[model samples]
Target: MTLNRRQAIAATAALFAAARAATPRGAFAQSPTTPEVRKAVLGYIALTDAAPLIIAKEKGIFAKYGLPDVEVSKQASWGATRDNIVLGGERGGIDGAHILSPLPYLIHTGRVTQNNQPVPMVLLARLNTNGQAISVAEKHKPLGARLDASPLRRAMNRESKFAMTFRGGTHDLWIRYWLAAGGIDPDGDVQTIVVPPPQMVANMKVNTMDAFCVGEPWNDQLVNQRIGYSALVTGELWRDHPEKALGMRADWVERHPRATEALTAAVIEAQRWCDADANKPEMCSIIGRRAWFNVPVPDILPRSQGNIDYGDGRRVENFPLRMKFWRDHASYPFPSHDLWFLTEDIRWGVLPSNTDAKALIAQVNREGIWRAAAERAGVPASEMPSGPSRGRETFFDGKVFDPEDPAAYLASLTIKKLAGA
Candidate 1:
C-alpha cells in the first residue's frame, strides 16, 4: 500500500524520535551532522507567509534538529526586521527571519542599510508563493478596478497615496507592476507610502491610502471590516511569483553551518506540513493566536486553503493562484526568480543599472543549502525540483519575463524609472 503524505510524515517523525534516543547529547536526530550551536533567533512579520517559521517553532521541529532554543520573535515592520537582522542575535536582534525575498539581496548589497553599509546575508529558501493582493479603498469601489487597474488611472495623482510594506520589497514590486501594467506611472502618477502589514486595514479605514498591496490576513481583514476590497491578488499579476524567504546573517550561518542546515531542515518540514490540505486549519489557528498574530482564524484560514473572497462581489473558491508553501518546489529558492526581482528593482531605480545581478545572486542565493536541508527533512526525491529556473513567466497584462534575458524584459516595459535616468 502506498503511504500518503501525512503517513510518510508520521513515519519520519518516528525516525526522528528513534534517532534522538540513539544519538549522543550533541548530535541532531536523523542526520549525521551535529549543530555547533543549540540556539538561534529569527524574526517575522504578522503575515500568513510567515507561517512556516511559526509552525516550525510550535511543532518543535527546531528541537528535533538539536536546536531547542530557536526563537521566532515578532517584528513590528520589515524595516525593523532588517535593522534587527543587521544587529544579529548576539547583539540582541536576530540571526534570521521570514523576510522579503529581495531584502536579503538588498541588505547584502547595502542598498537599504544604514549609511549604505553592506550586511552580508544568505537566502536559504522561499517560504511561499502568491497569497498577496492589491486592495482598493472602499471609496474606489465604484471604479471597478479588478485585475486591470486602468479604471483608477484618472482618479490617481501624486496626492493619491498607495501603500506597501517596504520601498523595495515584494509588496512594492507587486503594486508597481500592477500600476505600470495599467498604464499608470508608479513613480510619478501617485505617492507610494510604506505602512506595516498589520496597519494596512487601519490606514485604509481612516482614508489615509487610496490603495495598498500586502500579504494576508490584512487584505482579508480590510475586506472583513468593509474598509476596502481586493482589486487583484498578486498571483493574478504573476502566478506563483516568489514572495518571502528564509534569510540569515551570513556570519551566523558561517559560524554554525550544521546549525544552519538543521534550522533550514526544520523550516522545510514545516512548509510541507503547512501545504497539506488537512493541516491548514490547525496551522492557521496556531499562527493566529494572540501571542503570534492576534488575528482571527477566519481572516487567515480561507486564503490558506485557496479560497479567495475578493469582497468586491467576486468571490471564488479554490482559486488556482492561492499561496503555495511547499507544493511545486515552493520551498526551493530558485535563482531565476531572484533575477526577475532584481530586474524589476532596476526598472524602478531601486538598484543601479550597472549592478551585477548574476554575481550578487551567485554570492547570496544558497539553493545548495536548501537541497541538503530538504534531503535531511525527508522530502521525497520526486517532489524536488529538477533544477533552478522556472523558465519564462507571463503576467496578466500579456507581458513575458524571460529570466535568461532580463534586459530584454526591461526594454519591453514602457513605464519605468531606470537607474541613472
Candidate 2:
C-alpha cells in the first residue's frame, strides 16, 4: 500500500517550477530559483514497489512540476538499466531510472559486463528497500524446509536448477555468494538461468525452474498461489542492505542542477508519503493496477504493508526492518555501501586484484549529489551518511552484521570461499 499518492503528485508537480520561481523573489533565503526540468525518462522493472514512480506519474507529479512529459519505460534487465545510464553515456535527453544499488558501482569499477567504461552515477534517493525474496514452489516445500538445514550441501549435490532475473546484480551475486559462502560450488551445485520477473511464478508452477530469486509481488504471488514457499529473505543473508536507487548520470547532475534537486526533493516527498502504513493500500492499488505490476491488490497488500506470508503457515506482520521506504534516512547514499560491493566484487574475482578499487568506488557513487538533495529536502544536513553504509542492523533474530569487519565475518562463517581471501 502507498500513502498520499494524489497529494504527493500534486506537490511534486508544483515544486519544480515553484522551486525555480518563488525562491527567486527571496521566498527562500534569497537564493535564485532553479531552472525548470523540461522532461525525464525513467527505466523500471514493472513491479509493485515501483509504485512511487508509477503513482507520481499517474497522479501527474512530473507534470505537476512542469515536467509533464516524463517518460517511464519498462527496462529488460538490470544490465539494461545500467547501460541506459552509464555506458549509454550522458544522455542529454531523459533524467534517469530505477537502478539497483550495486549495478552502478559494478559498471564504474568495470566489475561486470559494463566494465572499463566509467559511468558517473548518483542515487537521487532510495525508492524502495528489501522487496526481494527467494521462493521455492509448494512441491518443493520439503526442499524449502531443508533449505536452512543440512548446510545446503544436500541441495547442491542433487543437480537442482536455480533461476534469477539476470547474471550481474543482487540475485545472481547473492545466489553465488550464499552458495560459495556456504561451501557449495555454484557451477557444480546447481544449474542457474535468467528468468524475467513476470515469468518466475509461471516457471515455478511448470517446474521449469526449481528455486527462484525475484522481487515482489511475484514472491507474494507465488505464496498466495501456493506455488512456492520462502526459503531465504535477503535480510537473512544481509540485513538493512540498500537495494534500489534513483540513478542519473553525473553529467546530468552537472548539466541541470536545479532539475536534479527538484527530482530529488520530489522523490523524498514521495518516499515519506509512501512510508506511512495508512497509505499502503491505496499505494498498492495504484501500483498493482495493470499499468504497474498488474497483480491483484491483495497480493501486493500484505507485503507492501509489511505483512509477510511465506506460503503455508510462515506469516509475519510488520517485520521491524521489512522493506523500508522511508526509514534510516532511507534516502541517504552512503559510501561504505559502495565499498562493500567492491569488497564483494573482489571476493568474487569479478574486479581485478590490483585496481585502486576503493578510489573507483568513491568516484562513481554520487555522494555529493545525495547529500545536497537531503539538505534541500529538509532532512538533517548531519543526517547525511558517508563511507560504507552497511551496518549492524539487528533483525527479529539475534544476529547482526558489521560491514566494518566482513573479512572476520566471512572468516568466522562455517562456510569457506572457493578461492580463499
Candidate 3:
C-alpha cells in the first residue's frame, strides 16, 4: 500500500493498460504505427479551442504513440503562424500548425503568403468547433448595440473600424456574416482591420476598434475588463460550425506517412479527453499556464465549462454548442466544410470566381488520412460518417448551405463582393 514513486507509476500504467484492453474497439488506445520521425514542432495561438494540441503535448499522448518530441509552441499571432508554417520545421519554425480552418485552403491556394506561391498543405484533422464570439465595444452598447447590427450601423461612420484576426479567416467570415445579415455591408459600411486575438481586448481598450470577432478568453476577458459586451456567440450563427484545424505541409505528410498517422491518432485521443466534461477543469488549468495562454484560470475555465457571461447583463449557465474538441465528429475534416470556406472566400473576392472549388478541396483535404488514423486508433466505423459531406447545414438565419450546390448558395447571398460583381 505504501509504494515508492516508481512503483506507483508502474501500477498506474498497469491500470491504464488494463482499461484499454477492456474498452470497446477503437476507444483511443495507442496505435501500432511507429513514426518515421520523432521530432515535430507545431504552432498554436492563445485560445481555449487550442485544447487538443495542448492536451496531447501535456498528457504524454504524443509519447504514448511514439511521437515523444512533438512540441506545441505558442505563436505571436495567426499571421505569424501562417508565415512560420510556410517556413517549415527545417527553417526553425514549425512543421505544422493548429490553424484557422480556412487557412489550409488559403495557404494551398497562395492567398495569404508573400509572392502568391502556393504552399501545398494537407489538413490532418479539425481541432475544434464552435466557441467563438463577436464582441462590441461599450461605446456601441449605448447606441443599443446587440447581435443585430442595426443600432451599430446608426453609430457607424467612415472612421469606424472592425477588427478580426485575419482578413479571410474564420473570425472575419463570422463578423461579416453577422453584419451582412443585419443589413450592414462589412466591406462598404465600415473599415475592417486585423488584430491578433490576444491583443483584441487591448485594442478595444484604446478605442482602436469598435468591435472584434475572436476565439475564447479574449472575448470573455473583454467582458471581465468591462470594455465590451458579447454581441453573439459564433455557434449561434451556425451550430457546430467548423473552426480550427491541424495542418501540415504536403511534403512533410508525404515524407512521413506513419508519423502523420501517429500524430493524428495522438491528437484524436487528446480531443476526446478534452471534450469530457470531467476533464475540463484540468484542461483549463493546464492551458492557462503562462507558457501556453498566459491567461488566468478564471478567465479560461468559465467558457470551457459552458458558463458564459456575455457581460451585457446576459449569461448562459449551460450554453449548448460550446467549444467541442471531439464530439459530433469534430476531428474529421469534412470536405463539405472545406467547400463552404472556399465559396465564402470567393464571395468576399478573396478567391477568383473561376476557381475550381472541388479540385482544390481534393488537393488540400486529407480526410482519408484522418480515417486511417481513426481506424488505427480503433475508432468504430459506425462513428465515422458515410460520406465526405455532413450534408445541408442550416444557419441561424434559416439559410441552408448544401455542399452539393455551393454555387447556388453563393448566388443566393444578398451581400457579396463576388468576383466580377
Candidate 4:
C-alpha cells in the first residue's frame, strides 16, 4: 500500500501476468473476430453446388469474417480435389473443398486414398442440396426413362457405360439408386465410368457415355445442346437430398479453429445470399464468369431457378424441388445425412459392410463446428435445426431410410453389392 512508483508498476504487471496465466490458451485464439491465419486455399469443381464458396469469395463475405486472403480455386475433378486436399495448402494444394458429402468419410477411412492411407478430414457444412441430375444420351431418349430406369433396362448391359464423377461420390450413389429402383443392376448389368463435371456435355456429345449423373450446368447444357434428356433431377429421386459439402483437412481445422469457424460462417452467409430467388440472375452471372465456371448464364440459370426442359418432350417450369443452398436447413451438416451416405457406400461395397456408421459419422462430421459457424454468421436461432436428424426420409421410389435403423433400410434393398456377396 505504501509502494513507490516503480514498485506499483511492477505489482500491476505481475497481476496482469497472473490473469493471463489463469486464462485458458484456447480462449484467446477462439475469438471470431481474430483468426490464426488469414489465408486458406479452398478448392471447388465447376458445378452449381460450388456456388456458395464462389459467392463467399466474390462478395467479400470471407473478408467480412477476418479471412480476406482465402482462395477459392477451381478443381478439375473430384479425384483431383481429393488429391489436392491430401496435399494441403502448404504443399500447393488445398485446405478444403466443395466436396461430395461421403468423400471426407472415404478419405478419413482410407477407403479412397492412395495406398489406403487415411487423410483425416472434417465435414464443416453442406454446400447445397437437390440440384444434381441423371441424364441419358439422345440415343436413349426413345427409351423414355423418366424417374423409372426400367425403360432403359433393355438398353443396359455390361457394355452400357454410365458416368459419374468419382467412385463413391454422390453422383455415383444417385445413379446407382435410380438404376436400382427400376430393377436395373448397376454393377452386374451396366458399367459406370468416371467423367469430370465440366466434361459431361462433351462426353455425351461423342457418345462416350450413355448417361451421366452430375451437378449443373452440365445437365442443363446437355439438354440445351440436344445431346441428351434428363432422366430425372436428383431432387425427383429424393427431394432435398444432401449433395455437396464444405470439407476441410482436420489438421488445418485443428490448427486454426477460429479460422475454421470464420470460413464456415462466410460460406453460410453466402449460402443464404445464393438461395434468394431475387439473386438468381446475378448469382448465375457470377458463377458463369470465365474465371469460374466459364459457362453461359443460359446453361446455369434454368435448372437453378427450378425450371427444366427434360428434352424428352417434357418441360417443367417453376419446379418446386430444385437446388436449395440455405433454405430448409440445407447448409446444416446433419449427422443423419452423413450416415445415409456411409450406409449407401456400404451397400455398394465402397465401405465395408461392418463399418460402424454412427461411430464413423461422429469421427468425421463436424456439426458442432457448423452450429458455431452458423451462429457466427448471424443465423437466427429460429432458423437453426432443433435436432441433428431430419427424421425418416422417403425416396421417390417409395423406399424409406430411417436414420435410426440403417440396417433395416440396407436389408430392405433387393439389389446390392455388399461385401462378400
Candidate 5:
C-alpha cells in the first residue's frame, strides 16, 4: 500500500494540524505580540527557487504563524525585486523579497540602486541552493562547449554577449567564476547583459545572447524548447552553494519584530515541506500554475525531482545535489556565506576594494533572527550550528574558500578586477 504525492501531502498537513491542536496553549502555538497585522507584501521572480514563499502563502503556513494577510506577488525581474524592496510596502511596493544572496550586501553597501543611498536590509534566511546553470546556445554544441568554456573564447572574440539575471548577483557570480576558471576574463573577454529568468529561453530563441546563467525552470525550459543545453549545473561548480534568500528592509523588521518572527517561521516550515521528496511533485504543480510561473508542469518537474537532461543527449537520473530548500540546514543564514558573496563582489569590482567584509557581514546577516524563529518553530537544537561559520568549503575546481581569511582568498585569485590588485 503506497500513498501518492497528493495523499502524502494531505497526511502531512493533517499531522501538522493535529500536532498544533494537541499542544497546550502556551507551548507550540502562541499569539503574535504585534496587534496590528500588516499585509506582508513579498516579491518573487518566476523561478522554481521561489517555492518556499509560494508554498507558505498557498498552504496556509503564513496564516498559521499569524501572517494571515501576507501577499506573495511575482515580480518581472530581479531588478524589479530590488527596486520594490528599496521602496518598501508603503509606497506600492514589497516589504521583502525572495532575492539573490548577494543582494542584501549589495543594497546595504549602496553599490547598486540610487546615487549611493544605501538601503539597509537584513537576510533572515537562505531560501534555496544549487538549482542554477550555465547554458549555451545550441549552435555552440558543435564547438564542443560542455563544461570547458575554452570554446567560448572564440565567440567572445567575435563580440558575443552573455546574459545573467543581475549585475552583482548569484547568476553573475556563477558565470563569472565559470568563465574565469577557464582562463577567460569576464570583464574583458565578453559583453554581459541582464535578462530576467522567465525571458531567458525566449531571448535565446532570437539569439539575444550566446550564453546565460539563471535559475530554473528557465534552464530546463531551454532544453525543452531545443534552443540550448546546460553546460554545467551550478551545483557541479560548487556543491550546495547558497543561491537565494529571504530578505527584508531592516526598518521593517525593527518595526514589527513579532511579525518578522512569524514570517521567518512560516518560510522555514514551507522550506521543510518543499524539501520532502513526497511533496516535490505537488510542489512543482503548484508553482507551475499559470498565475505563478506561467510554465507547464513538464518544464518544472524534472529538476524538482533531481532529473537532469542537459539537452545534448545527456541525462542524469537522481542527481544527488539538485536544488535544496531545507535539508543540510539550507535555510540557515550563515555569516560566512555572506562574506563569500561580499568577497566575490569585490573581486569583480562591484564593491569597493577597501570594504571591510567582516563588519558588513555582521551588520547585514540576521542569523540571530533566523535562530529565534527556528527555535520557536521547534527545529531540533542539534540542527543549529554552534557558530556563525559553516567552516571552509571546497569548489569543484579544487580551490578552497576559508571564510576566516577572505582577504588571502581574494589575493590568491588569478582572475579579478579588484581596484589595486
Candidate 6:
C-alpha cells in the first residue's frame, strides 16, 4: 500500500535524521570521495535573491562538498539575520552569511542603522546582481516619479509619504540617491519610514506608504496586488548592479580556512544550478515550499522562472540580467564593491566623518580566502586584485561608474548625498 504525501514527507525527514546519525562525524552521507569535514549555518531572509543558498542546499551541493550538517535558516529580516550572527546564534558562532553588498561596510564602520560598536565582517563572494527596485503607488501616477529629481518637494507639499525596510538598507540608499539626484533632500523633503517587505503591499493598500523599495516578488507583489507600480528596477538604476553577497566575520575565516573554500564551491555550483533554465521549475518549488521560501507557489514560480508580472499592464519576460546571479565574474567579491559601499556610508553619514574607508575594507575582506575560493570554484582569479579595482557599472541615467574615481561620480551627480562631505 502506498502512503500519502504527508507520510512520505515524514519518512524523508526520518531518513535524513537516521542517515545523519549513522554517518560518522566528518563523513558525508553519500558521496564517498568527499568526506564530511564540518558543518556551518547561514542566515537569510525570504527573497528571490536568496536563491543560490536555498538551491544549493536543496540540490545537495552542500553534501557534495562534505558539509552534511549544513543548515540554512530563513530569518525574518536582514536586521535579525545580522544580529543572529553577531550575537552568535549559529552553532559555534556564525561561519558566514548571505547578506547585502553594503553590509560588510555597515559592520565595519558601525554606521547607518547600526550606529554602534563596529561588527567586523568580510566578503566571501557575490551572490547576484540587479535584483531590487523602487515601486510607487498608483495614486501618484500622473506626477511622474516623486523620487525623480525631488518629486517629494511638490508631493510632500501634498503630504506624500515613502516607505522602505528601515535605515541602512539598499532601499534607503537607492531612494536617497534617487531623491538627491532629483534635487530633493532625502531626510527633509519626503517622509520615509520602515516597514517589513512582506507587509509593504498591505501598508500601501491601507494608504500608509505612497511608495516603497524592495527586492523582487515583493515589488512584483505590489504590482500584482494593484497597489503600486515600478518606478525603477535596480538594473535601470545601475545596469548589472551588485546587490548581495556571502558574508562572514574576518575572525571566522581565520578560524576555519578549508571549510570556507568548500563552502564557496558548493554555493557556486548551486548558483549555476539556479541559473540553468531547465532547473527553474524545480527551483521555484524549492523556494516556494514551506520548508524553504514558504511563499505561495503561484507567486514564487513565475518570477523564479524569469517570467515577471510587472503589475501595471506590463508582462516582461527575459529582462536582460533579470537578476543574473553568479554570471560573468559575479562571484569575485571585487574590491570596488567595498569602496562603493564605504563611500555611500560616508556620503550618507552612517559613520563618523573621515573613517579610513579603504583601510578598514582591506582588513575585513579576506582577499586570500576569496582568491582560493575563486580558483577552486573555477571563477577567474586574475580579475580580482589585491588593491582597488577600476570597474564601471551602468546605471539608469546612462552613465557608468568608475570606482577608481568616485569623486568624479559624486560631482557628476545632479543629486547629492545627504551626509555631504
Clashes of each: 0, 16, 2, 0, 0, 6
Q: lDDT of each model, Cα atoms only?
A: 0.93, 0.66, 0.90, 0.93, 0.89, 0.70
Better of 4 and 6 by TM-score: 4
RMSD of every candidate to native, in Å, equals: 8.9, 10.1, 9.0, 3.9, 10.5, 10.2
TM-score of 3: 0.91
Per-residue lDDT of 185-256 in model 2, one digit per residue for the tens? 666566768887787888888888767888788888888888878776666666666677777776767787
Write model 5 residue lDDT over 1-421, tens digit each, in one string.
8999999999999999998888875465345444246478999999999999999999999988878899999999988998898899989999999999999888887879889789999999999988999999998887777667887777665377789999999999999998888888888888888998888999999997899999999989999989999999999999999999999999888888889988999999999999999999999999999889988999999988889999888899989889999988789998899889989999998988988889898888999999999988889988887888889988877778999888888887899998542
- The list of candidate 1 runs beyond 4 A from truth reads 1-32
Stretches of candidate 6 exceeding 4 Å from the true structure = 1-37, 90-94, 112-115, 146-153, 157-159, 378-390, 398-400, 417-421
Candidate 2 wrongly placed segments (more than 4 Å) = 1-31, 63-66, 86-95, 110-116, 144-152, 380-421
Please identify which of the two predictions, 1 or 6, would achieve the higher lDDT against the true structure. 1
Where does candidate 5 stray beyond 4 Å? Answer: 1-38
For model 2, state the Cα shift of residue 208 in Å.
1.7
List runs of model 4 lying over 4 Å from the truth. Answer: 1-32
* TM agreement with the true structure for every prediction: 0.93, 0.80, 0.91, 0.93, 0.91, 0.83
Q: What is the Å distance of residue 152 in model 2 from its true position?
A: 4.9
Model 6, 146-192: lDDT tens digits are 32545545666435577777566677777776766666666666676
Predict model 4's lDDT versus the native: 0.93
Q: How well is each residue in 1-421 modelled by candidate 3, as lDDT tens digits?
A: 6999999999999999999899986648435576878879999999998988998999899998888999998899999999998899999889999999999888888888899989999998999999999999997787765666778878887788989999789999999998888888998999889999999999999999999999998999999999999988898999999999999999999999999998999998899899999999999999999889889899988888889998889889878779998888988999999899889999999888998989998998999999998887778888787889999999887778999899889988999997752
Query: How far out, in Å, is residue 66 in model 1?
Result: 0.9
* lDDT tens readout by residue for model 4, 1-421: 5999999999999998998899987676655458888899999999999999999999999999989999999898999999999999999999999999999999998898899999999999999989999999999888889999999988778999999999989999999999999999999999999999999899889888899999999999999998899999999899899999999999999999889999999999999999999999999999999999999999999999999998898899999889999999999999999999999999999998889889989988999999998998889999999999999999998999999999999999999999742
| Prediction 5 global C-alpha lDDT | 0.89
